[model samples]
Target chain A: MRPPPKSWPPTKGSEPLPNAPRIAPPVSAARPAGKLRGARALSGPLPWLLPALIMLGLFYLYPIAEALRLAFTDARLFDQATEPSLDSIRRVSQSAALPVILQNTLVYTVASVLGQLGLGMAIAILVVRAERARLRGTMALRTLVLAAWVIPAIANGVIWQLLFSEAPFGAINSALRMVGFAPVAWLSDPSNAMLSAVIATIWQGTAYSMILLYAALKSIDPALNEAAAIDNATGFERFWFITLPHLRAALLVNAILILIMTLNMFDTILSLTGGGPGRATEVLSLFAYNTVFQSFELGRGAVLSILLLIISLTLTAAMVVFLPRERK
Target chain B: MTFRAIPAAFALLATTAPVWAEDLITRNRVGPADAPNALTFRLTAFDLYSADPATAAHFGDLFTDFILAHPGWRIDTQLQTGAIAQEQARIIEQTRAGRGPDCAMIDSSQLATFKEAGLLAPMTPFFTQEQIDDLFPFVREGVTDANGDIAALWWFTDLRVLYRDVTLVPEPPQTWADLQQAAEVVAAQGLEGILFNAGRDEASAFDWLAHFWAQGGELVDDTGRPVFFEGENREKFLSAVAFFADLVESGAAPRRVTALSSYDDLLASAVAGSTGMFIGGNWMYNQIQITMPPEQAANWAVSELPGPTPEQRATGTGGWTIAALTDDPAKTEICAGIAQLYAGPGNAFQGLLPTSVSLFEEFETFAGPEFDVFVSALQNGRARPSVPIYPEISNQIQILLGNVLSGSMTAEAALDEAAAEVMAAYERL
Candidate 1:
């Protein structure tokens, strides 16, 4: 009788075997405590991260919130009056120097960021190639590139200031005299003040970009270069295709960071130009500082600070949105 | 066995009779490292040590002598250095916290601010009426509160005067026209003919106010109202702006003159021979001597600032004052004594003028020949308006002058704007 039917087991189970291994109904897809498995796992890490969160809340978010709140008040450092108003914002908006300050800030941000990026990328590539070629003293050369980054920005500013001074003993003027060219008022002339500040800033900030780019370059697999070389690609073509594609993430991040740094820079300009030659180099940061500490117009300064924060945040958001995404 | 023996020995000692049998040793009561009674005086000034070593040393000596005289009281002096504005801010913070020095060296310009902040103690309690009256009227006014009580002690004074290179100008300019003519001649000689503190700060205002006063401008009237917007004051403000603007426009002064923020900058320009003339304080004489070669120093001389007319000559008298910040009468008296010694007569500042009229003769003898010009300047000079809003007023003047000098605005337009802004600031105050 068993050999009589080849389809003894029906294609569809019309009937179940009573003695077959009883399996419990598939466990209900429910998470404990009505939470995802990893959701509650954050608690283990939360204690470890509490300090950093507290620090950011206190030092970063707190100041920003306070500044925003103050932007609506007519606050003075020494005044006891606490009248809440938008007069400061209105006053800042109507200021005549506001246009010039914005222009300078824009020019400075563009020039310095571009300068740093261009120089940083070039130097990073060169150093990477030098190392690949086993060139002697490449390490020393790289370290030299990092020198400006190691020195404090204010000290760097002062050094550049001395070099750019209109004084006869200034390094730039002395060099010009040696070359029989007329000494240029590097810092004193309105035309040159912002340019001088940009140059000083680039000198200091290039190292940061270079460092990031260099690390990115090193992370790039050398096998890609080898493959390109085998395909008869030139150095430029290899870098354009293989190296650059890998560096997109680093380049975008570095650009954002440098842009923010340049926008917020205050002490360097304070020490170097003092926003002088008729406020020629007075960026928003300097203007905010002057309004707050120097002029003691706290509310006006807060207004400027809020504007700066908004600009920075907008730019950051734009960059994050528009920049190419990294491969998963 | 050892524990039992130790307890027995301790018990024997504890049971010993006459615990106070040994004569109690008498010694001087313990005190701080300083003498039993010590006074710590804190002073904040621009340059207590490096700016003028002799004066700083004299102060140290005076404190030393005071300690020597007062047998029980040891004197302790703590000096901090920074811009006078910064010092004033620090003093304000310290006083508000009730932890400031017993006294602070306040700038004459800072008196109004300190008084308004209620940081100053009236000097009437510590100083005699005769002594208060003996100060120069402007000096007295600088340290006097709204109620006409002396709020601080004025000791040494400074007057803004015209500094010139003797080789370029054999005689100081007697009028604004003379100054212009001299500047033109000096400019023709391929030198920056003039360097005023055309900087966009209080220095510019301080320098321009001399010209403003000469042109008969008043920052605030006797009734403490801003009157710069009308009549003679408006005209004078306009004229002063035009004069400064002309210096920059005509290339008589360096276009870089717009960058000179401090008298120190002018002094440097003078010492470097880059400027043929400048307006600065008499304190520059010592700085010139300290910073310049003998020949270079000799080439520079100071005179009373030129006026619109010889009869209309004016200068600015500014100085530092010692404001008593302590509530303790004893501390206040001690601070007053130190302030008097530092700024009072017979200290022989040696080119620095004393603020007291009573000390003029004695100061003149030690102040040397250059101080004669300073004396004339002091006699003719007026203190800037000691209103709480003076800093704001001064800043507006600086902005106006800076705008004119930079060709951003015409003198008439700039002064009009400045006058309006100043009145607004006054109203706010």
Candidate 2:
């Protein structure tokens, strides 16, 4: 799979003008990909750029090509690749579990985005107000929230899985029972399982949203806030009128990033639920992973992967169009 | 440095180099390559290999023995995962990537898939005729191919059984009604009861399928096509699912049982003393010994898993096996020797049951009266279908358990849906 080796200082087959050679050119033993330029005309700066180009082709370009190739073929574990066909796409389309997987993906992405933004905005405002009043424990509180964010995703899953265990065994459920509430199956039930995963995701992600909104809040002019206060504005009035507008750009950016990340979330949920309780918590990424790695249906996995990629790209493009333009 | 020596060096490289299996497939290896004496052979290690300190010490002592017996030989084992299915998945993945272990320890159910994929070759050469003859009758039939060659050597086996605290339930449950009644009484006393794996795991299917098997129900036809939905098999399947569902419905067992993926989880609950009765593996006893106080461990006892009727009784046997992936005859022979260590001496201290009929006769550890239930249960024990398509059937069965337990679908609907999926997978194959 390696590209043919390149030799420096073109010898007998140099195609450039023989009269005036500006510099000795490096010739590729093979033609450049896609005929972007002639083999001989690949001159000036290209030789210097060859290493980067090769790395890009090898890592990014080649993998995409192979994935695309596999998507149209029949592939399996320890089986030889066969003729190009639409069998994998057909298999995915005909899957009895596809609809539920897609629905879970949508619910997970939306719930995670909303939960993170709502909780993140609340924390951001509280921290900013405390900082303005010069209150105690402001830094400590921020650090605590960031601590959840800094833990690895897998560890986050394990911690939450323990906390969400059933009844007397679960920390949260035990606390609930102590307060005269009946135990709830946080993970055993399908609906609660998705909710549990969303809560864990929001707990980990809220810090990033908080940091973004915090920076935006600090960017606002202090004089404007004083003027608003002089204008007989209530605390809520200032927050609604001035602070919300200032945070709009950050919030939009945060929403877009969070949605994409949640769409592809795998590790935490994998450790927590493993798409269990009858594939109730299986999202798009987990479905693709199980299909390819666990089921050993390479073609089916590739098809699912392409569908996920298309969904992410389309959403990103749509979100980009709504972004506030910078002044020229 | 001399031109005359170049040919001699090329000859040396050719003689020492590994002979790859396919089109330029390099046998991936990593270790101290410059070491003068030792050669590293990466072997697949089970997740249970180092699950606890005692287990680590006991399992480690065997490797220490192997190294002592063969100087300059190193064993590099990895690919440990908590769930058996995950471990199985990793084995196939590693082999697909050409980084597979030189000797792989895999679940017995995976042998057919490995053989069909051409990932395995005849193991007969490495094994002695006498050693081959020493395998348990069922194991011998299970391991040998149609060509009269040994495909793999099973090291150990286990059985599914229903466990209970004898003090909590003075009488063992022999039928579904008895199990439900016993659980209800325990539930009245503020204790959990009648738990089993009903999760998205193989145990969800493997553990409960024995109830159907006890009634002489066929999950698949002789040709290896699923027929659990046809005629008497249909009634058997529905009755098995409904009985468990009825327990959950009657508040005899919690819906949280659907979340357990491993017997180790069930063992943890049993050790905590909240559980009155649960369906689990014989190995859980060994785990309880390592983890629980002796008095607490003694309180627990196992019986043949309950059946639909008191007259019916069966236990499903499952085990792990070792296969040599190396084509080199020398390494294959070494792997065979290691397999013997696992089947006889290594399994002795690990709490795993011996796969050799002769060894089982002499092992004093299994001579106790309590283990009689397990030894007797083996008479009616059945193994899961070992066809390549069995994974598909087992996967759908796992989903069927999850869906039925979570109240997402009815038993009839779930069974029909699972059957449709299995048939679809069969057509693809």
Candidate 3:
């Protein structure tokens, strides 16, 4: 409101000496023209960014537009007539299996994300509290935990498949037999298939959540913890009040990412149970894939994909709004 | 030379040597000519290479010979690996893009889909009427398009047969009752009586259809409407499903078969001595030789699938059929020649049952008595319904079989459910 203090602009002599520093105006009170100049300075890299922008428009935006367009038509893989119709949307709504598939999808996504977050948080906390003498061993354990995440999803699915195989040679079944227990149908039975898939997913997914939370945990002030320790606060109380509150940002980010990934899981389920032993683990993604590729119904697949996109966007928006803001 | 010159020389060699070496190898293999052009032929049944390496080797040798025969032309056999449904989808994409292979080894069951889409070129221009007539009736009927023209050439094929452990069974089943009796005897010995696909998948559909046909059931009536929902046909369908259910109920087969997928799994179970019998293709013999130790493999023997009556032998035939896809007429003619050569009498040693009836006698000498059973089964083998709706119907049947196998539905209820679904799919088509 009033002119800033004379020293705010750096007091200067009446005679302008050669190579003297200039008295610049305050940034908050800069003129509109000066603001335009600031914006123009940021545009220097625009030409260099053109190729990336064009690529994203072509590969990402174009497919999304095409899917939206196809969602309104009754198109198939081999059909000649693709008349504009809402029949695909109607069919999806009327499908008896849709309700079951949607429920399965929700269960898989929620269970997988929570399992990953819980296990990852535990591992991250343990790693943070490890003694300096055991740092090497802790680091090795972290690497071993992340190894499953580093492999391809298909390879991970195959490894789990072998472990849960119903055959006598299956690792889990063989171990059970060794312990004088009957072998369980880990993948074959309807009841166990979803649980088996969720367990495998948690194994592959926890590593990512751990890394993010671990980094966030490292940034928390140790002095707060020392103060709490001096107060004779329990370890659980320290974690619940201090460590958890500090991890809110990382937790929100990790949860949203893992939620989207779990919703879109296709290849792993495909290579594992294939949505079967009678559609026991047939989630929305698998249902959409089968509708398009197996049933040759492209329109139906597009509609389901749009539905998935809506759910993902809603969850992301909710997380962004509810997550705590970091103070500057 | 200077040190910099030596590094430059090494870089030059790395860049230039492989290209020159490849050129020399290509020239030596294809022979010197103007410019060797690649004739890309997509093969759908690439698993045959793993199933029978000798047959695959023969195919490659024949392809090389054909390339040499045509100057300036080299053959490229592109292996497209997937389940039959996935491979068919790939072919549809290729054709819709107007970038089809020069030729493709297609599945006989899939010819109807391709023919309907106009993806296959008619063979009327290439083969004379007499030559076309030489093809067996079922083979001719299977590849005929809507225009009543042969769109593909039938090559090697196989029919489902009952395979049993010779030491366990001592006598092969000749009828449904015989099978039940044999199964009981085998089960009494603390071994599983049968191993077959009963899951909700393509393999289940194919394996179950053999029994369906054997019981005198028809998939579609004369007008192309599915008839399995009607009285007599419906009864037969129920009976066929009940057979597998009864097997599990009677402790002749393991309850685990409700989750079994492919004949490969059946072979594994058989090799492990968990099951005494299974219904599979003649190719199972080749697979057994590949997967099992010699002592275990020697225990297996093949026989015609037992029917409702001993005299009524029935099975379903399926295998690869060669179809021309090139737009160029000259290339089409060349593709026809290659197709004929591969399916012709000269390579019977490959062990696939030749479609040529004339070669049967010669094939028998080396094919042995086990293959004679396959040949006899083919005489009465029913071709799958060649319609666009067949895949949908197959899916419905798979669901029905899975329901029955899992004991979730009575045979009657499952059949009714499947019939309604099949009819719905047919109406949509």
Candidate 4:
């Protein structure tokens, strides 16, 4: 209004229009020479990483390579006549139980991952939404969940075994009988043993998944929710679009971790079943263990372990490829 | 941290080192210089014995007393439980690594394997001929290697006996036919006739072998091949399986019989008063005493296992053995000495009968009325054939028998299949 805000070009080396806010010229868009120098100075100590690299090579890389080599050869711990042969692989391929073991392993891994994720997410959301007065109790409950994870796997198996013992003297059977229900054989029966092991594993593993997902859920920006609400987005939509997208990285990390853990699971299976009742619940890991330790067919056992590793790595790589990367 | 904290952290370890060193030195010393105080020797047993604290404690005390009476020996003890395969592997590895214990308790059947591995030293060098001659033929033969070396000293001998409830039957059966009739009688009265483990493993195989042997079946013919399913033995064994199958089908025994993998679980059923009869070893006496009330315990009595014929009154005898693993002859000698003292007649409190024929007479007085059944059974018992391939052969038999008992296969078919498997395994060896 006052002379149209002095619409004129600035004089050379003179301060621009007084009424207009002075706009700093665009930075060259390149870092300063001093900053580049400083970055080079900061990176000078990176050569110290060599020792740790060497240690990893010796302890981890060498063993893994040796195991891979052994997997291709026949190596019996007790039988000296067992020479290097591909017979172990052929045996594994011809195993009648191979298909069933693979199916069970996959079912266990998927069920465990999904169950842990869903339950963990719900708990994390509630804890975040809970009022200050109720927060302390929720925190205590979370700690209790974590405590189960801290127990040794063998001890966990024994405790569960007592709970699910087939005899009337067992805790679960006694409780069921008191309720006027016929006692169910929780462990001896083939149908119930695998399920019982899964329940035990879930009781111990859910805490690990929950802690990671909770951190991811809490780190999402509240402003995004407000903005979405301003646009009249429904709560479900906001969660699907904003919350879930934010948690993508955490979920992928947790899934891979859970997959590795479930694939390598041994202690609980060993303590619970010992691959008994005519091998009703023999997982691949336990099968390998029996071949190595019990039967002393070390070469065959090594081959089975290598196959397991390959399967696990393949699954992990697929997960990494399919999962979405976080936005910058 | 200050230097004071470092010493404090190691205080307990520092003080205990000298005491342990002193004990080791004293334990190694023989003759007059040996410590008269009770010296603790750790023994690992199969899970069955190690699970009972009373048995372990009783055995420990027995050895302690025996050692105290000697001039330069003492007995102290610890017990560990592990699977047979696992324990054998661990001991073998330890011996090969040159870090084996001075002494260990092993299953009698493992004597051959131990000797073949060269892990066990001959005990004849340590004991006088009179001492070796004093042992029973069954015990002595069971622990001797192919080379005639006494590799182990028998302690607690396990012999099978038929346990029955007196309330169910006025008089126990005296023959196999009588037993079958008694089973039918018991079943009609709404009670289980007999309980035996039939799980496809070593235990099941052993149980079947006892019946097979009782039926005049030979484990190995002169050709060294298992005659388990051949000729007359085949018919007798199949007849036994048919009898069991009839009981299972007729609801005399539970369908879960095949699932009862462990001896303890089978014993538990008896203790719960669910079954009227069971086949078990001497240790079952202690188990029944602990698990059953005094009144029920009174009703239970042990009798010899009835055979197909009167002359076939044979039962399988097995037991634990103490063997040495040290290269130092002196250490080996001391270990053998400790074992002898523990296994001597005066050490009857250990819950193990003496293997020495002369020593057994001294402990006969301790048999008590309850032990009369076992003492009588031991008179006619035969040790299982001690062979290196025993475990594998037994496992195959178990699977076949389990299939027959579960009605998954015919008795003849099961026997034939098992025979083939055993032959194959033998050939491999």
Candidate 5:
């Protein structure tokens, strides 16, 4: 008696056993179509996702296409003439504002994502640890963080503005004065203004990451921790080996979402700094808004919106491709 | 065991019969809310109409008179709280959709753009030649369209004044140098020396325009091209920026001035007793009186905006205008009549000066010393250039002020940059 050749996966073009289960039905065979129509040419999820596809096409695809069309035209907000030209592109390209705005957007988004992720991970772990130890008031802590998350960005802007305002109006400055320290220009200085905006965004956005990472943390088996303890694994070693590997997918999802949110952030910065102290906190989204509404140059604004859309999509695509490689 | 549905329906109709019958009369028979007139006048007014009791009462009186003639003329009003520019933008959108209100209160500077868009019906059908003659020069100029028709009624205006806390600044500064020194003294005393609307908004641009005008600088030519950077005008522009730059650099004005977008903000600081002097509109003083304690309000007074020298004087006057946006003659007439009810240089809602010849004499408070300063300021008062490209110029100027105030760019560099941006936009036009 002999074991046949020990190759596990069948090689290409290898013959299958006569009694082996058939891989799907033969294409030549006809199947009755009721619910699952696998054999059909238009098979699988496309039909199931038709409604969402239609929505995306109508809302997302159409707006992007229209914006692209408008980008090359000379359009003012109220003007009816729609002559196609490169003036919008030329204006944005030659604009001194573009460089400053892009830099601000980058700084704001990167700082916000990093802050949200790191603070979120730490909070999520602490809360889970406290719950395991039967600590009280963890629910209250969660509610407070969630309160910041639930607040509208515009309201957050006003709240942060009052907190960041100078001497008499701002609590922060008043406290510094009480402590016999010179008041920091939280909203007046360019660098300070950007920092203030980033900090405010992080506070508002950290809840999103915390909830996601918390769910991931809960999914991690307590048995694994016990086993690692039995192996005499240190606290850091257990977290690095058992907990972090389990959270890889959530962290990736959280980073991508936070990146998109921070990139699109405008309402907070708008009310907080209004992109001032000399365009120091002016992100791309706000720049586009000012171009269209404030400056009334729709063509140039359209050009800026397209640039923003490209950056958002490119970053999302990169995260999709790059983040998964870490898993390997 | 159950009641019949018919009786319940009958009871419901009986309960609402009066309301339904009244509504039917308003919608179908004669006038909606009033007498026999079959028209409803829709107006989009600023927030004061809805928010201020005095303003609402004044309109209430006007409506009482209107219904006597228009009998059955129902009034429907919508209120907006945004600044004039936003209100104008909203109207423009509705106008494009062919669904604008019969009447809209717009910023005076918006008149030119509205006319260019063909969104306004000529006010000549409403305002008479005699009425036109009575308007302030800037109002007359602003309301007149390219075809020489009065397009909108500029009812009230506010003049930029040099506001001072009398305790901090004994006398109003008459010139830039005097202002600089006075503000320095205030700043040295640990008070905010001066404040102005310098944020990226119409107010900031409108406020800064006086500085250029005081130097005899013109922003645009007859062809609507920007002439601000040409020859001597360039020097004037440079000098104007330098004057403000000096205020910021010498600690006379706080660096926050670059971001102070609204007179409302300056008013807040003034009422809190932190501000020493500021250049603000006359309405700001009126607000101070309303919100500040009498003793505090007494310390605040307004004078005409200072100039390069005491003899050189100029001021910026901005006002709101009401326009008939509908082509329906009947609706337009109703709109015109409504506007005329409160027409003159008076606002019941805010204590802004009349836009034209006085009709506010009925109110004795209009005779106050602050208004006397406003009256003199009217002599040099000018409206913003209503040309469409003026917004672009203002936007660039906003950036320039921010740059110079931050000490990021020199005055010359900032001016050149602003000029280049404005010219590029002009070329595109």
Candidate 6:
């Protein structure tokens, strides 16, 4: 059996001489040198990515590895006698407050994610579907929404705490009293503390979801909508079949990001509740922090942190597997 | 050989000359008639001390006056905090490398660690015997190193008190039984009787320690060994714990008292009218005055912490101490002199306390009536156990007490467990 022709540089002569080795012409020719040069220029900035990767490895990866190691060691601030053991892990598992903390964390995360996403989607659709004549003021309104996102998390917590203060002097309580209602202890009551935190977090986080969904909504082809309309399809029908699918990728991305952010929420909770009202609003992050700083149980605190990391990683992995991957 | 010998001779002279001069300077500096020459001194203020401009100014004035009296001395002061922990770590690292601070205002607890590490200089030579006698005995005991040498001087004192609303309770409770009865009345009127630090942390331990001590319970024996498990003291402590548990469970105290992680939390609860009384210290008076309205502030008053038995009345006194950290004998003496000036009677150290004995004699006023209770409490205060393993012991007490109060463990069982843990820590120490 003869081997197939080699695809390489073409032969010098066109005519075949006696017993000339069979050679095939190049199947597809290269592009012009300018095109190649343009591609090279585009790839030139890729080297800058190395520094960013190195930073992530140092600041993010190294600390996480260290935390995992510390979690398994008997590390405490003052107590020198405690040997490393599974005691902390056992304590965490058997903790009476564990179930409640887990429940509260999940509830806060899910509720905030759904509430923010729904609200953000509605606002995004409104702004996109608005007539051109009204889009000017609508754009300004979007900017105002973005401003809420711009406030730092700690500052947001402070503002909400002031607003929710139980005293009659508080802004919300004062307003409630003016309307002939009794003042409510927003922070001191366990029933209200978690809900208060959720509201504050959602208020700040919804803008983020809105921006992503809005960008996705704007990118949907108008021609498809026009075609749907000509076929007597209603606005709702167009959104359901055409626009909704277009936003599926963005929604999944936004949901996963929001879930991770909410799961790791600490600053706002620390400033507002400090896991107060008898640990009613305690989340995993705050639990980990108190274990270390307040109790000086570094090993136990590290264990909690490791658990949080595992949960975050598992959820991220699930998102990757379950969400529809975007096609090129 | 001649050149090398010349360098060696000069080096020996150079080193020995300073030694003789230092000895001569020290001898002359302490003479009755001749005053020491002015020395340059540097001091650093902790963030908490520098929080208020007036407080900082007063400290500055006191230091300047001391320098003015000592003709050869000039004082330099720096205000710092964020780098405090790092600076402390660096000091230890440097000491291991053979260097450290001249003087530092260290927490009384940290003094134990430093003393154990053999990094502190004894201040007996710097302070005269009469001056030492004038110091509070409890403060003197707390500042003494294991070798019986005075290693530091106490700058300020803190003590616990039971603060109540005068309009609501009229007279504050003075005994444990009275407090329980008053708590019932307060609860009946729809207000919390007392706010306890039930959080599982150091504050919780400190709060509970006051109660435990008030019941005549000693966490450790005279020999500095754990003895919380056996004898009448254990029963008395458990009885107090039972009373506290009853108070919390009967809805007298806030049901969520376990969530009170900070003094600010208690203050907020009191200001919100959820609580009518709280166990706090002199610090809370200033905080309350700041957060409460004038009318509300007027309604508040303080009294000595209630005792388990009338004879068992006791308050724990703990505070910051200033210690010299340098190896140089002359510099250490100068730093000690500076500490003496700050902590000396009738000086700015009195200002550090809102109701010190000196403050009472000089100002003839307290920050408020709330502070009077603190003054009395301080007058009758017993110092907290000065064991080096205090942090670990405190943690065990807090966890055990919290569990007992929460009904997860019986008082006897909790005490046994805590005693065991404390003994383990003591052994390690």
Q: List A-chain TM-scores for all predictions.
A: 0.85, 0.81, 0.85, 0.79, 0.84, 0.80
Q: What DockQ does model 6 achieve?
A: 0.08
Q: Residue by residue across A89-125, what tens digits does model 6's lDDT show?
A: 7656765557867887887788888988998898888
lDDT of 4 by residue, B141-175 (tens): 87786679888888767777888888986577787
A best-first ranking of the candidates according to their DockQ comes to 2, 5, 3, 1, 4, 6
RMSD per candidate (Å) reads 10.2, 9.8, 7.0, 10.7, 8.2, 10.9
lDDT (Cα, tens digit) per residue for candidate 3, span A162-228: 7887765668989999999998878766768789999989999999999999999999999999999
Q: What is the lDDT of residue B152 in candidate 5?
A: 80
Which ranges in model 3 have alpha carbons more than 4 Å from their true place?
A1-50, A130-136, B1-38, B44-57, B345-349, B362-366, B416-424
Fill in the DockQ of model 2.
Answer: 0.39
lDDT of each: 0.76, 0.78, 0.77, 0.68, 0.79, 0.69
In model 6, pairs of residues that clash are B38-B72, B38-B73, B39-B72
Candidate 1 or 2, higher TM-score?
A: 2
- Per-model B-chain TM-score: 0.86, 0.85, 0.87, 0.82, 0.88, 0.79
Candidate with better lDDT, 2 vs 6: 2
What's the candidate order when arranged by decreasing TM-score? 5, 3, 2, 1, 4, 6
Residue-wise C-alpha lDDT for candidate 1, range B202-255, written one tens digit per residue: 767887888888877888888778887688887887888777777777877776
Please provide, for model 2 over B252-330, each residue's C-alpha lDDT reduced to its tens digit, 9 standing for 90 to 100.
8988877877676687678777789999888887777778899888888888887878879888788988877766666
Looking at model 5, give its docking quality level. Answer: acceptable
Using DockQ as the yardstick, the better of models 1 and 6 is 1
Error of 5 at B185 (Å): 1.1
Q: For residues A292-325, could you state the per-residue lDDT of candidate 5 as single tens digits?
A: 8776788998999999888988999888885646
Residue-level lDDT tens digits of model 1 in A100-168: 899999999999999999999999988998998999988998889899899887788778877886654
Report the number of the highest-lDDT candidate: 5
**DockQ for all candidate structures vs. native:** 0.22, 0.39, 0.33, 0.14, 0.34, 0.08
- lDDT score, residue B230, model 4? 76
Report iRMS values in order: 2.8, 2.1, 2.2, 3.9, 1.9, 6.2
